[model samples]
Target: MTRTTALVIAVAMTFTAACGGGDDAAPETTAAPAASPTTAAAEPDDATDDAVTDDAVSDEGTNDDPANGATDEVAGDDPPTEEPAGDDSSTDDSPVADPEPADGFSWRAPADGEPILIGMVNTEGVPGLDFPEMRTDLDRAVAYLNDHGGLGGRPIVMEHCRAAGSPDSSQECAQSLTGKGVDMVLLGLDIFPGYTTFSAAGVPVFGALPILRSDYSADAQFVTGGNLTTMGVIAAIAVEHIGAQSVGIVSADNIGANTSETDLTNALTAAGIDYVSIKGGDNETDAGFQALIREAAAGDPDLLVSLYSDAGCIGAMRGRALLGIDTPAISTAICAGSDVLDVVGDDAAGWMFVGVGESDDSMASIEFEAMLDDGSGDGASGAGLGALAVTMIGTLARVANMLAADGVAVDGDAIAAVMASGDAPGSFPNGETIHCGVVAAFPSVCGFSLPVGYYTDDGDVATLPGFDSVSAIDYLP
Candidate 1:
């Protein structure tokens, strides 16, 4: 799922509950229904209290019977009893190995020099939605960098601000950071980013992913592509990989979902393929999911694409299994998360997931594991979005080092230039070559390709053949 979709689901639910529909709204940040690899942003642009209403799902001449609530309630919808687990397996025997930090993605040792003050903004301490781990992970990475000889020997200092998941708080953060004279700003799950404030102050912004339209065209750029890029890749998979002549798409009926569905349909239209769209509420019961899936599969298309995440993932998988509908389905990486997989078990089979792939023993993966290690024998206690934080900071470090090596000032302007220079460089966490400005529609998105995978019979995600890192440029609108 993209940042906007994830934010919409969480924020929309909160507002709905505030408006006296508390029972219907999804609660807490536990396991977000659709928190994908790029999720961590705040509330969405058009997500209001009404966005979570039952009327959001159209009758569409399909649902005549009353909605009988599902017995197998999906996790992540209710208030979290314990801290939410990471996307990786919570099982005892995991596949990831905890190796020492590798040399490839490691930051260079710098001569001791002046400290480079960096500003970071994140959403935290909110009632229903809060993720302090986003900040904690970045702080850990900053400390590690400073310890390892700093940037060009210049120590890195962070000026952190916490947002309360509101535009006022977000703007306050931007305004507050500008006064601190920080070189640049890093955004971590800011719902309504104060981009104009930073732009006027000549402060360049870098974020984990695009959360709104302003994020794409503003002075900021993102490490990961958002919904547009993902939809493009889905289109590529539908037309080129699966050889799908026709497709059925199912998604929640909201601004974010509508936008993403439109994006996919546009690409499908351009590719000359037939498609039917089915929209429903963000949180649906088991029977509701079955109804939606039955309607979608009624056409017997070559493939099924789902834009649902979190509990919806469980519902979809269970609905398919119960109905015996085996048509290959494609969804965001969130649908493949361990939270959902642990619930669905073997029912997760036959679903292809985009945005995430298998956990390999590559140098990049090793470095990622090292960053999460707390010195205990166990792996990273904080993985999920914290991993995103590590990747973003590591990418910034790599860019800064590149500029310093070329005898240029390692400041905001130079860093921005290198990102928009149209040159591809090895990115951290995966070491995949990142090419920014590849998609004209989203110039700020640095990721042109993403790893695609499918679940095996054992309910584990594996890299699909010939789709380890498929580019979305060719299929994008």
Candidate 2:
């Protein structure tokens, strides 16, 4: 199914699934970027593939009453006293991104002011959704902004909303955040297609990168990132960086994928790479993934780019390990997480993925130190990986804070603008902010481009891509 369909189905059935590994992620410790990732170039599989999902956390953390929609409790807390934001809206399926940003509006403070509450929502270790480590990373991001900057003299107050097991609950969560009179919202619709709800609520979210393509700029929405165009960029990276003359395409077996497949194929062709697929990138199984990887690997492509997930990463690692297909495996930002690096151990050594943030441009380094002070350094390599994660968290918050400081007044729109075309400069890698979002196509923003490193490897596992690239390209996305 497409992202939206998948979400709809996931929510409609009241089924809970675990995604990404839990606290199993250990931070990297070795210093600055070293050892750029090596893919050993070639072609990808002719057959398509998919990503993997983990088991969801207990009902207590997210919501026990899956059938009840978004009235979730705080796991350990008593019953919630608030009314629910019922699932009550529909959406269209056009990938056309919201318009390019218009001339921005300057802040004109209205004298008498009550604090404008900004409602923020993220995957704060949501029960089933663990891929986006919101709490340790995202939470620190907010703190950094508030402590160092504080939005234009008005402090930002955030309410952490949990993602529901079902899409109904997802809508509920969005509605609930809207009902709170949040001036703007920073949200992600990947785990919850709450776009419809937010749109209906007339809340213009700014920071979220929704997986589904809806009217973000309508009275209902606002989007900033280089939307549908990014697909071509993704394909180009697979062809150039991964050196794949030929690639096996994989997509979610849903309407959304169907809509985009033609464009993706055309883009790949325009980029001068060969691609072929038979659907089934969104929903998949371990055994199916293994067979799929085998088929893809058989193509002997220099790069193995799969639209897969952590679970699928695991399966692909195992499948390749079983068959010994050691070419580099590249994927989207969706699967990019520090934890994913540790999932397959030695097998994960050469795994390459993509996503936002410039190495120097992001706040991961600064946040790492902060996390160390906050005690997240315990089991982790302490400052090493913990530091990196802290930096990642700090990066997002810094961007959010900057938008807030500029008084852009919308989370999704501001973040999207920054991601797609924000032009202000900030620290990245060694400290450089070249473009607004990620200027050129993103193999970098699509991923951190980390080389395989381990504490036991006796080399720097903490830093990625030979340090210089961190500053050279700027990892901030």
Candidate 3:
């Protein structure tokens, strides 16, 4: 199932527990869900707490449900005490394994092949902002790679580190991954401030999502979009396609969102488009969003742009709908989430946004769909071409393709060398090409262009004709 579907299932299952109002007793303690094998280094208990919170507020609202008075009737209900001799019941009572694929979607690696170890760092355990799904996606991609001719016939193995949205946790993960002799590091939507650690150790780091200043300029770090290029594309679309000569921005009050605002401002000014920017809380309330939207629209902007998180996006859309404003609207990819769309309903239709990959019928997209169908990657989450599944699978596929082309053994040093040689593969999952070190301000940004798409009345995103390349836009120093 898609990530959206999975989230819906989770929400349905817990809706009663979240919204039930009659109970007044303490809730029962349940076993935490198991972390995916790829997240081997994560603290299970800590991660589980965040996961539960994410599920509880998947739609970002509070319910008046009193604590359920449920308790374990049999406190010591562990497994049976008796052992079943040679054929132990506990050991042998395994579920049936999934049937092997009957088509080409099967593992092709030699059984005894050497393993190619790739390190991954992701953010998790931060309440309401964890991304266990990122690690899960990478794990699924590695499994798919191993099944479809592992990197140069070597099985791909991922060693993961959980940053948990803290500098210390990030550093610890970097240090641990470096010490493990990993070939390269994949930064999966991490807010870690420790890319320097990997760079100092001469390890090349590839970013699935570039969310920090270091992500743009760090030596040996290459990312899908450098320094808000994706936002730049959104700005371009606002001016070019939407006929928006004057634009207003509702930006999240965060470092990354501020950077995006600056980038977009530069692009809009260069294009001779008039623009005004206003800041809002990343998790603004409905009233706060209405006021911000009204204030921004008061200037008679031709278009409204939301550079906030999904929550802020929902608020902005609701605010606009309430005011009956019809100005063309656009948002960052994060704002186009399934939850946001569901909340906004028909109001989301005709809104434009930027994405990293194409939704077209390219061979890559076809293969990606097949992988998802075969359960090879985490279902879609995130926005644009760099959705969780796309980024994980695309980044790894590029790496594997590069190694296979050179007939080189997959090793850390060799991979780093290739990345630094200025000839590393740059094809994204959406069939876009990126060249690292091409921009002075964003030296490590690979893909500097983004695809534009509009939401339909049915809440589906439809890609426009072509992508917007903002390479000429000046970058902030």
Tell me the number of clashing residue pairs for each predicted model: 5, 66, 6
Which lDDT tens digits does candidate 1 get at residues 27-109?
A: 22222111121012112234333322211111121212212111111101111122212323366787843222223334334
- After superposition of all CA atoms, the RMSD between model 3 and the true structure is 15.4
Best by lDDT: 1
Worst 10 residues of 2 by lDDT: 5-14
Which is the winner by lDDT between candidate 2 and candidate 3? Answer: 3
lDDT against the true structure, per candidate, is: 0.59, 0.36, 0.51
For candidate 3, list the clashing residue pairs, or say none: 107-147, 108-147, 183-412, 355-384, 356-385, 357-385
lDDT of 2 by residue, 243-357 (tens): 5677665545554445345545665666677766545555466667667777766666665555444465466556555667666555433333334435655565454432222
In model 1, what lDDT does residue 382 have? Answer: 20
Please, what are the lDDT tens digits per residue for candidate 3 over residues 1-477?
122321110010000000001111111221111111000000111122233322111101111111210011101111112221233234466763422221111323331357666777766667744666555544544545555555555666666666766566678778888788877777765565467788788787776545655556776544355336655565566655666678888876765566667777877877778988888766788889988889888999878877665566688888888888877777655545566776788776546555522243333443444333323245433332223433434544565556765677666566555555566654434434446666666777665544544554444544443432223344323
Ten-residue stretch with the least lDDT total in model 1: 13-22
Best by TM-score: 1
In angstroms, how far off is 160's CA in candidate 2? 3.5
Model 3 TM-score is 0.71
TM-scores, all candidates, are 0.76, 0.54, 0.71
The residue-level lDDT of candidate 1 at 314 comes to 89
Badly placed stretches (over 4 Å) of model 3 are 1-112, 356-358, 370-386, 389-393, 412-426, 468-477
